[model samples]
Target chain A: MKESLVIQANNLSKKYRLGTIGMTSLREDLSRWWTRSKNGIPKHGFDQAGIDPTRMINDHEFWALHDLNFEITRGEVVGLIGANGSGKSTLLKILSRITEPSEGKVKVKGKVASLLEVGTGFHPELTGRENVFVNGAILGMTRREVDKKFDEIVDFAGVADFIDTPIKRYSSGMTVRLGFAVAAHLEPDILIVDEVLAVGDLRFQNRCINQMKSIAESGKTVLFVSHQMATVENLCKSAFLLNMGQIIYSGKTSDVIKKYREDMEESANLPISQRMIREGSGKCKLSGIEFRNDQNKVVDSLISGKSATIKLFFDIYEEITAPMSLSLGISNSTHVRIAHLCMKTFGKWILPTSQKSFQVNLSLSKLELNQGKYYVTSFLDDESGQIIDWVTDAFVINVLQSDFYGTGMVPPTSQSIFLMDHSFSF
Target chain B: MQKQSITVLKPSAGWTGFDFAGIWQYRDLLYLLVRRDFLAQYKQTILGPAWFVLQPLFLTVVFTLIFGKFAQIPTEGLPPLLFYNSGLIIWSYFSHCFTGNASVFTANAGIYQKVYYPRLINPLANCVSGLLGFSVQALFFVGYFCVYKIFIPTASHFEMTSAMLTIPLLIPLVASLGLGMGLWMSVLTAKYRDFNQITGFLAQALMYATPIIYPLSEVPEQYRFWASLNPMASVVESFRFALLGKGSFSFHLLCYSTIVAVLLLLSGIYFFKRTERRVVDYL
Candidate 1:
């Protein structure tokens, strides 16, 4: 016998207007009421009428999730993977009934418990013991159920010693741990986790993941959202890859990962200016930034320990040749800077010409950056120590894993970066 | 784990009604929240629950001195202390409930954003907790009445009737009115936020508009129609009549206030439910 699916979302979409004032006043109320009334009954399978032409020009309306369709069978652990702003959180919010969709409909069975953020149900003034029952209730567990699971939750959170202490006094990690324990023990039919495990220490993170795994194994459908691809691969058999508010790929975890990697590579090929860069303080003026491989074709791909150059074209608006220096730093997707290179100690090259546009290329025999998303930042400084220009995030690049480096190390070195040589004779 | 005992199932589509059953299921959570509010409010305070009694006692003395002794406002033949204290007790309960419910969304926006709960529970729990505070204050009124009856018996006349039993019924009515207005204002404040600043002023204006400091009969007869139109005016008068058995309690006014309370409460819940899911988007 085939098991029935727990959730079925058909052509679901959500649209939000940008930078508009929210509901207020009797005038806006009457207008909104009229609009909602004239649009006909908002129900599943009905097409939403177009926005009123009489209204002022809206800056823009973007679909957070667009034309998505999927089904999840009971007890399936489905991982939702996407880059930032890819609508993973939006989808989860809709599933958890925290918000309604702009279009389409979703059908869910049984009670749903969503841990969109750890410690969401906790009140700062309430004690740890009080929060357990309160949060458990917020997640749909009955009082007797909380009582039955109270001890188990306290033990799981390791907060029995401070159970009577107010949550306001608890550290953030402790709060998150206790919050997760309450949600985990509630035993809902469907569990929604959205990057909450990233809050605590490694041990707590491991415990949360294991709890989720056990939850899925206990015949409950689980929808897990995370940027941690390895964790997704290890836990979820099925995966959905979201890109630009659309489902780009949905299938077995391996296939989705492959498609996601390919899509990342395609995005990497785009010019740094055309690619999305988070709004940054443009203190330092950057004229030109390019990534080029050995053939000098401005290719996106780079081989570990192979020759590559970051050609930085700059213009010095204010003339100061006082040991002016250039520095470049690379950062991962989480914006953690992994490596840095500076021209201060290397000595600055004199401008061949006083023209506004000039080029400086940094050559590397081997790229020691790991295989993942990387962004580069360049800074301009005076040798006299008075910094002239500083650009925090200038360009982004993707460093793909190559056969030479293997999965763990860069530059294919026999000895690690620590340069340790060990012979175990136990 | 046990062999997949329950088969996979999907949630039903379409507009769903308020889940009363779900709210009932979370009753324990509601109690926990109520308990937390009760304990936490007086936790660090020096006087603790004594503050509850002192507030009304002090306010009653002040009101008696100003309205009774100075202005010589008529109290419909009740002792000045008994008259003023009755008004203060009822008004305090109403004001506390209104303020508490009105700040529900703004105060709890952090938790509202993170988890999904029946948003109704926030206001409901607040009303329940406010009732507890009101009860503590009501005990003070009883203490003062006992002293008045014993020490100053000839200063006032007192009587008890079955109409006094109707006092308990007014609890739900007063709660619903406060909750209704509170939720409506709470949702609006979430969007405009200016309402938060203005609410204190509005509540003060409402207090003066109601017969909290003076008797309903003290208002000019021409303005009595307008004063009685205020829903809370009838509520405060009814509460006074129930406790002191002196103020006016028109059955027609009671019916009208009850109707208004019901309408406000329902509309408040409707607007609150509509805004609950989307409030987080703005917050």
Candidate 2:
């Protein structure tokens, strides 16, 4: 017989009305009352009336999570991987009963404890000991259970000396440690954590990961979501990759990470003009950006140890051309910028006309970037004063590996610097 | 090829029901919150818990001077100080419950957004903590009653009746009213926010509408019907009548107030339950 599943989701989907506020107008209130009076159930439908023409608005409906289905058996530790808006948090919220789904259903068999954020359910006025009970209760643990594990929690948090002190006085690190300890010791059947480990230092994070490993080993289910692929790969046996509110892949953790890397590469290969730059305040803006090969054809992907050209196309919006400089940086999925190249020493390429675009191509005898997603940052500066344009990560490009790099099977060895060459003297 | 039969379980609506077992399991949390509320309010104060008694005493003196001496409001032949103190104590409990519970969502938004718990625990804890405050004030009333009985022996001859037993009975009733109304208002305020602005004004208006400073007998006979219809009016009157045996306590009015309280409490719980899971989204 197949093992029993602790959590089951069938066609679970959540849709939120884009901009509707509260159900408070007299008419809406009356209709809600009528529906509840007639059926003894709160109505769950949205008003489809056209937007008020007086209001400045455009698109109305946006599905935060489309059709999603998955399952987890007892003792299974699963990782959820996705882009920022890919519905991972939404799924966790639904599973944790924080929000209701717009369609479909989910069945969870045992107690669930979710650490959506650190220090949740902690009252600043309450003592650390008091908050432990409150936080544990909020996470679905009994008071007696928390009491039984109180010492362990205090020990793990390393706040034994300050447990009697009000949490308002605790440092941010202490607060996070105590919060994680209470959650880890809560002993719920299923644990759901969402990027909470990102708050603490590396040591605490490692401790949390170890605790999660122990929890998983004890025949409990775990659902972990994070942008750190290494952590996900180390902690989870299975994984689900989500993109654009849909599950793109669900299988082995390593395979899903590999697939996500490939997807990133594919997106990075898009032309610079088509890059989707987020709308917000940044250091600088790119007037024009494009990547081209020696043949002058726009290219997005480059093989490792191969010649390639990066064209920095821009127009000088400000006038202060004194040793104007530029730098290019590359980063990985975790957003750790790993490399930087500057144009201060290189010969300057002057614009042909005022307010005109210029291109500067850097010829690499060999592309040293590893097989991963890398973004470029182009900076412009003038000596004795101002930094004109410092557009960082303006565009992304993929650096593929050739057979000489050894079948692309070996992970990149560089922690910070991308090695340009490797040779053996025999 | 043999097709495998998969057993799929449908999500049960029963999971949404009140998990009493869960609440019982988290009792320590309830006690911790009650302690926090009790201590935090008076942590740095000079008198500490003595402030609880002073609040009712101060209110009673002001009400006696205004409503008793100046307005000359009748107290059904009961001593003005005792009469006003009893009403003020009970009314304070209800008002505190209302205000504290109504602000539960807004006040704890930081925590609620980050965690999940039976939201009912919040209002329940507030009600219990407010009860402690009211109990402390009630002690002052008892002391005042005892001194009045000893020194002012001729002032309406104090006597405890079987009705006195009803004080404990009415405590839960009054609490239910406040919690229910507060839960309803808190849910509404999460979205409207105008309600938060108006809550203080509404609470003051409600105080005048209820017979806290004076007896129901002081109102005009024609308006007695309207005055008695205010659920809190009957609740306060019933509490004073139970303790002092000198105020109106009609069974019919009590039945009406009880029905209203039960209705409010059930509807409040229903509205709170329906909205608690989603209030964070709006907040």
Candidate 3:
């Protein structure tokens, strides 16, 4: 324990049984209890170590978080960056007391408020004014505290005229704004947020960022988790990168984000067939994917306003006369989808022959995507709307900048992910 | 310098980790939850809050027809309406408290998974909110009893007895038994979902097991011991004797039910506190 440190974790770990967590039947519990009583109960869990992977696969037990140790000092705004299932959420759950850790401990000084979600306990039947008090109390604020900040919250949400109406009638955007407003007014010693900024419009997002900045400036601690690296870069000074239930890097936010990018690139380098992260039935599968320039030479990156072609190689196991549709989406580093190309929208479908394998080429005369790192997600669906194959973050395509308007200038990628083809008449 | 409080969270709180103070700190939330339950139930309906009184009133009349008039069940010489209303009044409180809290973990898993608060607050709120309906029905019962004794003819055997002094004491007895059993059932129902389907059936069977529609004197002496083990049996009978002054009452039976209530309350708190810490993981 240190004088300035507000939160500390020592060897914290959480083990989750993959399926059928506990006894589902009294007969099973009874038999197990009888055996344990006769053979003497075995001491297991928590302190148990050296679990083999094969045994874990068989027994359906795995540690979601393993021996995580970190500390946050007062007034520090830290970002936790990790891919899906990298244990960021488990750590947050343990910190928020929503779920207990399997081993070790986490200590915090002063009161802590965790907003794992906005409108955590809102009732649709309750009015906006009533829901505000309920949501505030669920976030650990007292009745008098909510009363003191009621006017400010309503003003911030900008729903003064409809405060007495049931939130069920409010638009989804209005509900989100009011929910975020109540959460933002909580004055706890420490605040933990998880992807709540992914909601609301751009204007409200900016308001939320400003409110977070003011909270940090007031010497309160914040531990934020998000998939959006741009927001992390803007809000956090230091960050931690987690991979496979362990902290791989911890340093300046910029350096950590670079490490995250490198991690994504490394995963993208693997051959498509060998990647473990995929979904849908295996009737048809993506065998390979490649990007090529206008000259038909294979390239890893495409330049804006230049002709390029994307080739998708599929392997079909059982063929029929059913028509199938193909879709490819490109998303920026912030995980926001920027471009989508679907065959069904154009009223065109593919009828695969008896061939076990085939290649489909999508040629673009001029790339409209802005200059940035983008990830590709591919989906294949049949006539019945059943997904044949779906892969996310299947590959990465780097888009380079070009002057579409021949002005030798371009807008920042942050302004928009698409560069429109236009000319100045004035 | 401002004084700071440090909290250290561990894997488990062990057997002795009863958090009475934690529940006390979240008392405001408990009150708000109770208010929400009371206000939110009858919304968007024509008869708002009137259903509170009408529900028990309708049940009492139905029971008076089937069990009193048709089946010829004895009410220990009291009017059938007064007898049935007396039983339904206390029975509904216990049943509401029990069944309302029985599925607490499964019903509120959404909130419990994302927030941190005393899990006991949910069931405790249900108990308190059950009182709102109980008081309304109790008032109706008192008015009906007055109508029978003073207004209705051929009903002159009713007299308020000294046992009526213990009427206020019956509230906690019923509340604790219901909450205790409900807490235990919450854990069981969360563990085995099929158990949830039978809770309503069990509550109905339990009502018949106790002397709700009939007097305790009707049960044979051989089965009275097993009947007294129900915990609610003595409470319901004592409520009848206290209010209408014409039902069975025994000191030993009352003492026995009191002990069961105390034990159930203590053990229910212990088991609920232990289960709630990690209930969300499995749920």
DockQ of each: 0.36, 0.26, 0.66
- Per-residue lDDT tens digits for candidate 3, residues A290-402, read 89998999998898888999999988866646888989988887677778989999998988678888888999998888888889888888889877777767888899887
Q: Which is the better candidate, 1 or 3, if ranked by lDDT?
A: 3
- Model 2, B1-283: lDDT tens digits are 2232332233334236666865676677677778777877886689988888888888788888998999988887888899888888888888888888877778888777666666788888999999998888887787888898888889946666788777787898889888878988887777666678777887889999998777788788999999888899988887887888877788888888889889998888777777776676666
CAPRI-style quality class for the chain A–B interface of candidate 2: acceptable
RMSD of each: 8.7, 9.5, 5.4
lDDT for residue B24 in candidate 2, whole number 0-100 = 78
Please identify which of the two predictions, 1 or 3, would achieve the higher TM-score against the true structure. 3
> Against the hidden reference, what TM-scores do the models get?
0.79, 0.77, 0.86
- How high is the TM-score of chain B in model 3? 0.97
Question: How far in Å is the alpha carbon of B101 misplaced in model 1?
Answer: 1.8
Candidate with better DockQ, 1 vs 2: 1
Q: Candidate 1 docking: what grade?
A: acceptable
Q: Please state the error at residue A80 of candidate 3 in Å.
A: 0.9
lDDT scores for all predictions?
Answer: 0.74, 0.74, 0.85
Question: In model 1, which runs have C-alpha deviations exceeding 4 angstroms?
Answer: A1-3, A23-59, A276-426, B1-18
Model 3 ranges with Cα > 4 A deviation: A20-58, A276-329, A333-337, A340-367, A370-373, A377-392, A398-426
Question: lDDT per residue, candidate 1, A1-426, as tens digits?
Answer: 234867888888887654334645556656667877899753222111122222113334557778888888888999998765578998998888777787888777777888887666677777898888777777778888989999999999999999999889998888989988888897778889898878789999999889888888888888998767778887899999997678988999978877876665565555443444122222224666777887787876675545688788765554444445677776665444667888766766443345655678888766665455566766666555555445445566666555443435434433332112234596
Winner by TM-score between candidate 3 and candidate 2: 3
Better of 2 and 3 by lDDT: 3
